[model samples]
Target: MKPILLLFIFVSTLFATQYSVIISKKVDVGTLSAQQVRDIFLQKRHSLGNQKIIPLNLVGQEPSRIAFETDVLGMGRDRLNTYWIKQHFQGITPPITQPSHESIKAFVQNVEGAIGYIPSSMVDNSVKVLYEF
Candidate 1:
């Protein structure tokens, strides 16, 4: 019974959700490698050719944010926090944050260079998906 229960939980977790990295439709980027996406979010690479990239983040400790940091940024919470702290003194800062996925979509829709991550279900014709995982 315990084995069956554990299997059920694991399967549910695997299929429960998906994530997407999105950008404004007007930005004109075709596709981005994971490295490029990571660079943009880390503020390591500020632009994609002629387009100025603006990374938007969800507010602290949000599950989607954690997934993004883990899957995309490849950093755990503590390490990422340490990174941002160091960047702060170097005149670099983390991305702008929105409280909810709805706000992320709205900002990306209205702002030309904006990019953010959100649950794949919330996506619509308003934004272009750059990457998904």
Candidate 2:
């Protein structure tokens, strides 16, 4: 019984996902409120002060994407898909999608005003992390 419990804990830790919200180092906005992060991702708010903000999303089916949507965006996959579809009808668009965490890091590093969430393990000095979850 103790062995089974230990295995369960190990497996749970192995599959756990940690996410960090990152912005270009050039972006002057320091840290952001959780609400602000949600708004940015949802396209409710665009620019932070004078700097134009661009949010990026990981491709569908990525665990980090799942975590970010569930935790930060406060929406599940089905609801988020529905929301974007409705926005498309209104001529509003969702954030650009990157295929991987590495791609997101590279893009955020090179693009001013870009923001994205990636696995906390992938973070480095190239971008500034604004929040973590």
Candidate 3:
């Protein structure tokens, strides 16, 4: 590859935003493993025992969403689309989507068992961070 292309890659990676998985402060569940997060986001697992979990997604093309999907869920866009399509046939639906980090934080803060991810910088004490990446 060209030197300029390599430099661009390095710069882009250096500046990439970090993300965190957050849950409502009211949720009793503590830290979660990556597989647990993946299951929740993919709708393969619903609740942590009696407490139901509602996973939230960002609307449209958000960088955090892409990072969460790639790093946490370990799936590409096309694969995720196909997975959701197959899930639809099995009566499973995708996670609810919020327009922005603010909205996701608000929803998680207010809802009982809500869990969502946002840019690490956007997190405050209003919600509990389950994981960071």
lDDT of 2: 0.91
C-alpha lDDT of residue 112 in model 2: 93
> lDDT at 46 for candidate 1?
93
lDDT of 2 at 36: 93
- What TM-score fits each model? 0.90, 0.87, 0.88
lDDT of each: 0.91, 0.91, 0.91
Candidate 1 lDDT over residue span 1-133, tens digit each: 9999999999998887898899998888887888999999999999878988889999989989998999889999999999999999999999999999999999999998999988999988888999986
Q: What is the number of backbone collisions in each predicted candidate, taken in the order shown?
A: 0, 0, 0
Candidate 2: where are CA atoms >4 Å away? 1-15
TM-score of 3: 0.88
* TM-score, predicted candidate 2 vs. hidden true structure: 0.87
Ranking by TM-score: 1, 3, 2
RMSD for all candidates, in order, please. 2.1, 2.4, 2.4
Query: In candidate 2, what residue range of length 10 has the lowest lDDT sum?
Result: 24-33
**Candidate 3, residue 32: lDDT:** 89
Which tens-of-lDDT digit does each residue in 1-133 have in candidate 3? Answer: 7999999999998887888999988778888899999999999899987999899999877888888889999999999999999999999999999999999999998998999998888988888989888
